[model samples]
Target: MRHFSSSATRTSRHRVIGALTAALLCAAGATVPAAAHSPATPAPPAGAPAGSGLALTPPMGFNNWNSTHCRAEFNESMVKGIADIFVEKGLKEAGYEYVNLDDCWAKTQRNADGKLEADPVRFPNGIKAVADYVHSKGLKLGIYTSAGTRTCDSVGIPGALGHEFSDAQQFADWGVDYLKYDNCNNLGVDAKERYTTMRDALAATGRPIVYSICEWGENKPWEWAAELGNLWRTTGDINDSWNSMLSIMKQNLPLAAAAGPGHWNDPDMLEVGNGGMTDTEYRTHFSMWSVMAAPLLIGADLRKATPETFDILSNHEVIAVDQDPLGKQGTVLSSDGGRWVVAKEMQDGSRAVALFNETGSAQRISTTATEAGLPEATAYSVRDLWTHTTTNTAGGLSATVPAHGTVLLRVAADKHWAAYPPAVELALDGSALVEAGRTAKLTTRVTDLGRTPATKVSAALTGPAGWQVRADSATTAAALATGRTLATRWQVTAPAGTATGTYDLTLTTRYRAPSGKQVRSSVPFQAHVVVAPPAGGGYLSDLPRLSASNGYGPVEKDTSNGESAAGDGKPLTIGGQVFTKGLGAHASSSVEYYAGGACSTVTASVGVDDETGAKGSVAFEIWSDGTKAASTGVLTNDMAAQSVSADVSGAQVVRLVVTDGGDGVDYDHADWGDLRITC
Candidate 1:
């Protein structure tokens, strides 16, 4: 239900581009200021009838927006196929129940009777037929429409603004069970009045259709939408990237007081299985959404989803947290640097704790059960949702989470503590970059945190095919007593012709539990394969980066930081100075290039891009190998371009990083202008 224009071609009946652009510009940057609402935001009046009984918890479903996005493949067959996959892939059993259709489902114009009509070619059987099919699968059907004269699709299908009653009646007649009303092309109408009209119209139909207001939190919906819709969006659209997901999460995590049964704060849809992030990141995405009690509407194409995607979607433990009858949104307990600790109260007196690491390196995050709001007890049961393993902890809960990963734990007091396994933690320490044909040594430390000892503990490391991996020291031990650790070292060798990029390795650790069962934990490890650049001076943009991650869109080669769309940037400009060659990136971004141990120095002019108009703040750092070689403490848009030079002799990889300057990443567009490297 995002309010962004799609690439669908418009019909002659639609308004002109100039008019649409004017409307879009008016709605641009409509996000409500943070001061407008907070965790203390009051709830709706009691006995409010809007969405009184529907969506008692956050909705769990699939919306065909992020994946197909009005493409040719987004047809009746695809919707039916998704419903079928819901049933066939255990998603239905896991508590997902809705099959939602997004924009471009309707025709450009209404029918002769002034009623909305489904696209004939895309839905030959009409929406009613698709709704019937979805209902037959024991799932609800959700349809999308804007509150203006046209939908978000560039083709401009009929909206429900003036025809609210008629469209609501038509959807009711079609057996639609959910409605995602978006905000686009509203013609400057008041958001509340526009959405209220549709709400009243839907209620008059005498059906139980769930109303989801997609106003992008422009008017502080959390302060007023609880009495009007079942769920209201609290942020803009979500893209399938870590920074996009993290930024949205930060925006939505502060409005916990506005969410509850039948009324919730929607942070947009799930981006799992979208392929933009690693599986570890997807797990964190799912875990955080569940902890925050956000709608679990999947945004991936189910017909082509991988097994890993299905696994993340169908995790019953995580899903239960999202669907908890308590309906309390998670609140941030602590946040320092890039580490976050969030906790949610469940219906049965349990607390769901998420130790999230947003940094670019592995970190040890810890939180006590008492700090998580659990009552004092002799022992607590710590359940790892992703690993599906339960362990007994005296009081402390901790994990060494990977970069952009989460350790989701459900902590609760348990009387039968001896029945569960002892908690064993794993941590990996070693270099992250290795030259081709060279070897690197990595160490894994296993510790027993439970009261009892873990027997026959062992660890092993495995790399990609054609790469050599072996244990350099003892990998097994008789037993690891409480608070004791066993460290093992492994030697890894990349092939001589290994590609210059990041490679994944798995570190698996196993131990025998008190119940005589084997417990296994597998952690993902990344190693960069570097080959120095050609022995010459050249622009840094000319070389292929080993890895790149931007906060907004893809890092640009030679332009200013633009919007969320790739290749939309202009000439790179900093403090009114334009550069023809540089990297345009957003805050909290990183790009690594293989220096091949040949580059002697790297230089650049770094500053906040003027495109943000004195509204951005960021700090730039250069990392040579694993050490910081140079840094610009903090740069703002008001400052001129500052020169940065880093000594990079014998460095295998050079990394350029830009971080948000203590504040959030709200307009932190940055530019690395005239960057050059000398070898």
Candidate 2:
């Protein structure tokens, strides 16, 4: 993060800085050679005389890594060739800067003086000359480095860990404008410390270098990455394919609130210039990232530019949203798997919303209404950022977005969004599950998505199976939709004696709409109340949950499809018959299987009372959809659990059923969460 005055000597220096130590160093005088650290050479402040247009804004330029990096016997001429054209055709004027050399650009190590130098094989004229050329064109220069012992390219060299500040000085000496700090073999307490270390190192360089920390959010560094560097990687590297881009974007949007002007969520560089995806998908990629406020680090060869690529990158309206002086990141307001609605507040108090569909199949996303906590009704002149046209619609809100695409509009509260008030307000990350004999309570408020506040509205709560209702929200005609959303809550208190199980609570929004239809919107409320297993509970209480950290293998075929009571329960009723015929896709048997017996096979607790019944053992069964298995085994006090591996593959034709393994009131609640199959 170091920089030298134009009149200073050029000497590359590298050194190791201690972890977490803040280093303070800046270039002499007011000419801050580097500005906003735009992944390129950090641009000096906007009007620092060393910056070009949009310098205060994040740079929109292309790199070589995503698509083609140093291929085809290319060298400095290849990189400089692109910059020359960028300047010649006024691409810089169009707001694209920082022709960067991502990887394979640096040497194994610095010279005897501890200077970090570029590989002579690639940039023969040196990074300084390239920086000068880039500067001549009114653009900025950028370089890359590794945070681990090596880079993604796997070169055997020391990383910035023990040598952060020193490397910062070296970059400044080389006239480096931007430093792309990568994480290859990095190991630390977590992502925060690693990023924090480099951030301080760059600062120590005394040069205004943008520290772009690439850790891929292994430990959620975005939570506080901004404090350490200008940008931090939020996900793994993205490819030029639609699926890859979509996956990366999916996880980034939720963390949008973490980004701002100086610090951004880096999506491991842009794949816009990459040829793997179609032009349409590329545009969608750009649109999604811009809306989410992710760093627009172009990852394609800028030298061989495409018209379509230029169009996607140069959309003024989209770019406006990305570079909005407000510097706010867009976040998901509502989301389903197929479609999602996201919003970002703009400087003019206007809110931009994008309804995006990410499915291969056609999907429809509708924005019913919303509220932004405004006092009075406001009108908005809704304009589509993609089509660049005004949408003529009645009422002050909502839109239906297309499939595999998005509908981004500047929702002017006073214009179109004015008439709406926020109605449905959802709180907590999700529903709270009360264990059996426990209580569940959560609080949330709703406001108007429009200018008019939701004054008085009613809410109703309903549930399935056993639900103890506490209050009828509708009795108060309580505030229905705030900001157009209904302020409502559903709380169910299951006394210690309540049955142990998961119950679904349905929340229905009832409100007197401006249209006077008394709209009722239903949202599913889920609650899991697992009765504390009456003291010493759970068959395998110490077993790990099947999660990313603890993956479980699939079921192996070693048990029997027999007719005996080895299952310990009466003959399992199959297809309404006592005989185990027509069970599963098999010709016979819902019979008991064994694995954990003697050394039981997958054993379970059938909670049934073995105290009074002769037919009290739970049996295993399965129903499959192609290959997805829905295996069910009984849980009872009598026959705790029995495993039967009846080959449930293509399990669609099978139905896992549990029955008659308990005496009346035998506490036969079949409780199972970690139903893992070990291969």
Candidate 3:
């Protein structure tokens, strides 16, 4: 295990801001403002189109990890079925087009030509057939491999490392459109070189195979992935659990600006509709993925999806946000108390926002569009994507967000709308509005999310694109007046037909003295744009296609029959579709379910029989991957309709395996969903 050198980034808390800057930079969608970037950035590639935006626009597709079914053999029918389902099920309608095959799907070895072969058993017709099927459906096909000589599988065939050109040719021959080059063996400095090697190699193939480096966040892909590949994984494997998902999402904010039309930071795959998580949890999962602008690869049995699953996967508005041509991935603006408020700016000047409650209890998360510190005075229309309706607020003038879910709002200020710093408030002297030829005097207004004003801020801007600064100054920020926050009298002149695009002036300021740590924030120079409209598109993952039933909560409810759950009837539900069902119940209150292969649909129910004094509760849970799938208080109920029954849908690594601790209770019914397959 190669260790990372933390000493370098330790001094600076490489937390959220870094991620935000990256997302912002990439959000420019194909047009990278190299001049606007921090001077510390390396020079742009020579011979490459100068300032041309990302290679790909409106990156489309779902990843396999979301609905991946590995280890099990997949035939042409299965592979073709995926394409048909993707189109028929409306994943493509949601703007997703990539049908990525992750990890496996390869033969045990590559040929002497260095061409990787598909598992013949799984592809009786061949890899070309698979690609053709995907293409016929108007979707692109992506394949996976490791950057190391031998992959994480240890026996993975030699990939593009040493034979980059050969591998690229093989992929091109196979009509492969995308490559997810994972980092398995090589670590540290070597890992960086390997990815770069493959990147250059793929480029040599003459065909544009979108490069996706999957290194699991070893090196700062945010710092380099864009230059080398179209997309890169920011973290390691993401499972179908809430904890795993959150950890990866929280670690990615600093990389937001780096994502754009072509290059994206992958957060693994979608675990929704996978039979392990509840629909609500899946909703949260989809919201987070869309907000992050991540690749939506589904890993589930698509053949078994329900109609509601189709609806969730086919949501247009959500897909629009994800595919927004602007391609700026949303970052975590604020998070606290098991509640997080994340947001993304849309091309239409609105934002796709989400309010998530990770805890079990219902949480009220209130927020203002201003609190998240986006453009202000802008009008917003609140659309509840899941509820499929518009949210009613006191005023449509702005947005008021609620709890447990998101109010996907569209906010648009008049063309005159200007962005403000949330923590600082300034009174702009409007005389700066339009000076025929003279430079206007601009000022700053900033306030905290709480609306408290901030003052005496320092601001700086890279010289205007076409004009040299009238005042030759770089050592000090534009002057800030007392009782004022920030001010700059720019003698800037616009070039004829300059096309008036939004110019990002890196306004660096140290507004106040440090209380405990140094703080700095950047504000982009805002001006009305007269250029072409921004790009737009988004994607929905595989999660929306599965019927999830349970959101397992609390354990140890009623009377215990044994160690396992012995409910008179229904068992408990966890996540959503996953249920902890009981086998049989003689009579008992509390029942214990040990973790095992049967945690799929762990359901618990308690009942009282007049003849057989059964008066306890049934407690069962899915424990796979060493964690409980879902838990709940004793399942005791008089009404049969109210008896607990859960339907689990995902958790690829940990199959639900429950045990019966035969106590006083024998669960009348207990079962789980998405049962684990053991060879």
Best by TM-score: 1
- 1 or 3: which has the higher lDDT? 1
- Cα error of candidate 1 at position 121, Å: 2.9
Q: Write the per-residue lDDT of candidate 3 for residues 200-262, one digit (tens) a residue.
A: 666665555667777767667878767777777786566565544654665566578888876
Instruction: List per-prediction Cα lDDT, in the order shown.
Output: 0.81, 0.50, 0.48
Model 3, stretches more than 4 Å misplaced?
1-58, 65-69, 187-189, 373-380, 391-407, 413-679
The root-mean-square deviation over C-alpha atoms between each candidate and the true structure, in angstroms, is 7.9, 18.6, 23.0
Which structure among the candidates has the greatest lDDT? 1
For model 2, the local distance difference test gives 0.50
Cα lDDT for residue 78, candidate 1: 94
Cα error, residue 505 of model 2, in Å, equals 41
Task: Name the lDDT value of residue 457 in candidate 2.
Answer: 58
Writing each residue's lDDT as its tens digit, candidate 2 over 423-500 gives 333222222445555455543233233333343455566655565656524333444333444434446676666654
TM-scores for candidates 1 onward, in order: 0.83, 0.55, 0.53
Which residue segments of model 1 deviate by more than 4 Å? 1-49, 334-337, 359-363, 465-473, 531-547, 563-568, 592-604, 610-639, 642-667, 675-679
How would the candidate models be sorted by lDDT, starting from the highest?
1, 2, 3
Tens-place lDDT per residue, model 1, 365-446, is 7888999998898887788877777788777888888778899888888777767888877777643566779987778788
